[model samples]
Target: MKRAITELFNRLRFKHKLFLSYLIVIIIPIIVLGVYAYKQSEQMLKIQGIGGIEKNVDTISGGINGSIERYNHSVQTIVYNKTFQKIVTNDYRDLVNLSYDLKEYLSPYFTMMTNLDKEIDEIKFYTQTYVPEYGESVQLASRVSEEQWYKEALKGTGSQWFSDNGIIVVSKFPQFSNDKDTNIVYMRINEASLFNNVAALAKDDTVIITDKQGRIIYSNQQASAAADKPVLNTAQLSALKEGVIDFGGAKSYLVKKPVALTDWTIYCIVPAAQLTQNAGSIINATLIIIALCILIVLIIIWIFSKTMLRRVLSLNSLMKRVEIGDLSMRVRSESKDEIGELTNRFGSMLIRLNEVIDELFRNKIVQKEAEFKALQWQMNPHFLYNTLSFINWKALRSDAHDISHVVTTLSKFYRTGLNRGDNIIPVQDELEHVRCYIEIIQTMRENSFDVVYDIDEAVFGYKTINFILQPLAENAIIHGINRKESGRGVLRITAELSGGKVVFTVEDNGNGMPPEAAKTLLESQSSGYGLKNVKERLQLKFGSDYSIVVESEVDQGTRMKIAIPA
Candidate 1:
């Protein structure tokens, strides 16, 4: 029994186990939500009623915004015509003529505005006086020299619009191309019709625009005397003005939007229960779905869990075999389920793991051989040469001096190459090696060429791949100077610390190689001793990100600089 439980535990995926757990946890409770066990019908009726109200109000709010947008477009067209622009653009003489002709040009606007009176109680555009005592109805043109909107438009600022009373209004000032643009035309809006349109258009609720005092400036539904009566008092408007709210008694839901550049809020109110009637139905249906889903899951899990458990347990045993060093083991599955997918992934992982183990052993043996080869290749001729030099010195003291020159050349070559077994030696040490090689060559072949070393002291501390600089200098000496037309050739070597890097250059005043030859020499094949080996070694150690720039002209000198990362 314990073995079977262990097998089952290993066989099941985490997600399937979680699903089985969820079925046990939620199956009973979800079945209960679907029951709707409440006996009271009144609460149910209220829920259904309020839900209907929300749907109605949502529809009304959508339409009212559309209607308002349409009216705004019409008002914009009437006030910003060409005639308005022409009159406003005129000189002082034209201004006097405009004052007379403006009323005729503006007559169409007034005519359309009067038609709104049929839908709304009243519409007026007025300028306010500091003292209402002077006259209750003070005309806008009388008190202010210019309206605020006209002032803006006069400077070619563009059109202006506002909503007041129950109407939407717009204004446009005239433009004078010769000087500045001004608003000479002021078209009044009738806002009362805005509320009338809202009330008429909104099937489920009322639309009203009011001041802080809660006076109804516009009602969209009715032009009757009752339209003038404010539905909400100052107190109720105060609540609406504060913001949108939910009234629990009415099961109401309210949404409000405030107009930009204004204090007024556009509020849409509806009963909450009505908005979610469909969602409530969906919620109830979801309870049923959940119960059904759980029961089906349980039945399916019971039927298939044991069969699945068998195959996975089989795979588990195979994996254990592999874990215990049986790399030949593999799991086989035919079904396309979560367990099957996982087994497939596991099989691939096992194959790769075995391959990696085999490759690792192979690499170990190869690395051992490489280390042996490198060891055999390292040579130190220094000891033999030094012993020979001591013998030569003793013979010279004994009056046999011919052997001294041979001993000296061999010693120089040996000591320079060996360098006391130090791999990363100083550049100065490298220069000494080059000097010894030159001396050896001079003695052997009677080679005579000028070699000058101009090295800076700052770069000695840094470690480098040894023999890099020496070969460059050697190549220059043997190939460049030896082949030159000039009888006396010059080999100039210079190095310095430049911008935190060691800049070592060896330039010989020999006949510089042609473009193709110089390129081939610098990037010589692996079989040859040239710049290619240096470049590859530097790249393998550092990366391609570091720069090796080579600049040369045929007759001119070659400049190669290695730029290392800071």
Candidate 2:
């Protein structure tokens, strides 16, 4: 199966392969992200919608409970008042005097209760005794035992609610003087004012207030006809919980909370579709934008893949030409892309190959010339040594010690410098060559400076480049000692083995060059031949790892340090 798949992929063109890759890498991810974002947004909207409805229900329930509490307090005030209680319990035969006393005692309590709450329209006291007829605010009951609310009020010990003419709160008064008649006191709140808070909700939302038996009391939809009022039948009400409901042919969020003072439940109903409308619109817009972006990206990929393939095919054809001995062919491209970089590298490789061929051809000619020069050097050095030996013998015979010493030093210097035509020699031999060169310099300058050696014996057997030290000593004598102002000049050569490397330093206590001059000594075009020659040779032999370091301060001294692998 894998072999078949590979063969099929190889047969497809490059552009088709790139298109397939774009579908996987770009198109698939966009679709997945859009779907995931929609789901998350939808869930968030549902939670927030339900939470808002619950808060509204809780707020309305709290306000209604507070209004009911105030009404109850009003009822209790009349029941416990000493003045009104006295009037109700006592009997008087004088109707005018009795009416005046009753009004005077209860008028103040009535005025305060009515003014305290807008919901309390009237406060009434009903009794069988002789009382003046003072409208509905204070009245006498002709037959009090016949009313249902009156019987219900008698059954309970405390305050009770009833829907007679309006919502009435009736509380029974105790029989103070052992009479067969019972006195009842009630406060009536208008039905419209009772559910005023719920009516202030949004028009689309429905609020219903129900008694403990699940019978509707005050509803925001009460203005509608009885048939049009929202009804949750017993079965639907039983099915309804606290969160969401799907009754009445519509989906809605339901919030139910019971009023604390009264056992009435307040329901806030919000439609589900209204809550998530904005989220749905946003999701649709996002999917459209993603689809448009994917279209643009695919177009760009098609154009870019074709351009890139053309360059690659061009490079392939050039490589074929070079394979068959056509080295003159070259690729030219102005682009800064990877393919252009490949062309530049190929061009550089060809140039280097040509240079190497030319260098090999020139080396053959140089090799023969070196052999001829070697033969000439062998003969000329023998003759020069013989002549120097003859000069030394004659000076010895004539008892000229200075001349004999000079000739002998010159002979040793030449012999060590040659070193049988080998580039590398022992440290001891290089040091001996420096000593001979220094003797000649001292003789020529009339001993202007002194030479000192602080070399370690262990480094004497180690190999070093020949003639490295002699040039440094010559520079010290010619440039440093010859230019000193006052104090006696001193030349010091030291060598030691450190960290598996040989370090040789040539120091001179003579007139020193400036710091800038010392720093550029090796690279300066005006620098003497000896310093530049030593720098180049060290770099060529050790590939820049070994080098010469020069440190100098004006009028102080100069120090040249050479470090090489031991």
Candidate 3:
């Protein structure tokens, strides 16, 4: 059997083998993960559903308490009223006075209470006084003496709430001055008002309110019925906890809350299947996702294996050509995988081999051509200097000393700037270059700006980048001195060795730019390339540690400084 399996695997194509391997590796774990995720999602939904039901129960309990509170307040009002108590407990000498008192005071008070709180359906007083019962509003205590709610109210010093025969009752029994007069004030609450909020619950959900004795006093299912129906049997009720339970052959989540006024417990029940209904769809989606992932992975394996095989075959063909001494063969690929890497290395090796074989002849020819080019370009700078000298001589012969001086300064500036194409020169030579530039500028502007040199002699021995300060001085005269409104501008050029580093500063007393403009002067091309070029040359010649800085203030002067390592 093992041999047969091996033969089958060996007969399969590379992509097929890759696909099979991936399938075997991922199928079991993906199934397990999908199942686990479904269970966890279902559990989370159950917990959230239970929590939601608990909140609803709390809200329902609050509404019921509010409805009961209003009726209880009415009962207390009638019980504590001195006049109402006196009227109810009064020993009437005649029926006419009793009738007059009821008509004038008692009747109007009850009517006002019922009108003020629409939830109060009726208000009745039960007493055993000799006074005759007027209407249904005034009744004999003996009529309710045997009732459970009445007996309970008589036992407690405070008020009591009772759900009896689809009616909500709040009663207050006050200690009367006459022992024979057991006075009770009763206010019946509108059942609709008591359960108004519970109507928002889901249709399948059920709410049950039970008295302290574990007897159902009210159920939404039997709300209109005269007698309360039992929702759960005795066994189920006894075994109920604040969690999932088996009810009516289906799993239901139950949350219970106690009513503060009556000590009654409110039970909220919802089917577990309803709570986790979405979990089934989620699981189905997860399974579909897993299947898609498997399909995508198989496709990727096939594509990758095919690509690798094609690249390897191409590499083999290139090698065969190379073996036939075709050294110019080349391959280009943008892939960054191992095969691509191998292809790149092979191409580089072939190029290096060809370079080694041809390097000697190539270098000799390049050297000969370079020499010929040098010979062709040797006369340009000398011709420029000679022309400048001839002009200076003609200017001197004509007695134009200023023109001669300007030409001489220009010649010197160009000579120092060239420095035989050397990038580094002595600090003294760089300083002389700046002086030449300033002289030419002053001659052009008719000495509008005066320049002071505070260069330390110690700096003269050090070598520096050529033409570093000339552009800076030019910028100072152009941007600063020329823009000054009043007073002659002064240019101060200073170079010194401080803290083992060379520092150069060019300060001009002219109309300075804003501080922000000064900070970006070396970076903005709109200002000109003079300062920016100097900055780039310094950083490139030295490392990035060397740089230029500018400080300026509006209406004040500007200062440019360059710092470089010695």
Error of 3 at 479 (Å): 95
**For residues 1-566, what per-residue lDDT tens digits would candidate 3 score against the true structure?**
99778667645665676677667656755675666576755565655577777777888888878877766666777778877776777756777777877999899998998788787788888887766788988888898889887888777766777767655565555664546557778777777776767766634577777877677766676542222333564356657897877766778787888998877888787778777665445557567667777676677667756755887999999999999989887766555556667888999899888888679756755664454345334557798799999999999999999999999999998788777766688888889998998999888888877889998999888899776788788888888998999998899999999999989999999889997788677887544337776776676667678878888988898999998787
1 or 3, which is superior by lDDT? 3
Q: Write the per-residue lDDT of candidate 2 for residues 36-148, one digit (tens) a residue.
A: 57665556676657777777877887787777887777777777876566566555656665677656756766777678667788777787665555666456766566887
lDDT of 3: 0.77
Q: Pick the candidate with the highest lDDT.
A: 3
lDDT (CA) per prediction:
0.54, 0.75, 0.77
Tens digits of per-residue lDDT for model 1 on 121-224? Answer: 22223322221211221134343356443343334433334433224344444323554432322334444433444564445454545433345444442432
Alpha carbon lDDT at 114, candidate 1: 55
Model 2 score (lDDT):
0.75
In candidate 3 the C-alpha lDDT for residue 169 amounts to: 62
How far off is residue 400 in model 3, in Å?
A: 99
Error (Å) of candidate 1 at residue 476 is 1.4
Please list the residue runs of candidate 1 whose C-alpha ends up more than 4 Å from where it truly belongs after superposition: 1-383, 391-413, 420-428, 439-448, 496-503, 522-550, 560-566
Q: Global CA lDDT of candidate 1, please?
A: 0.54
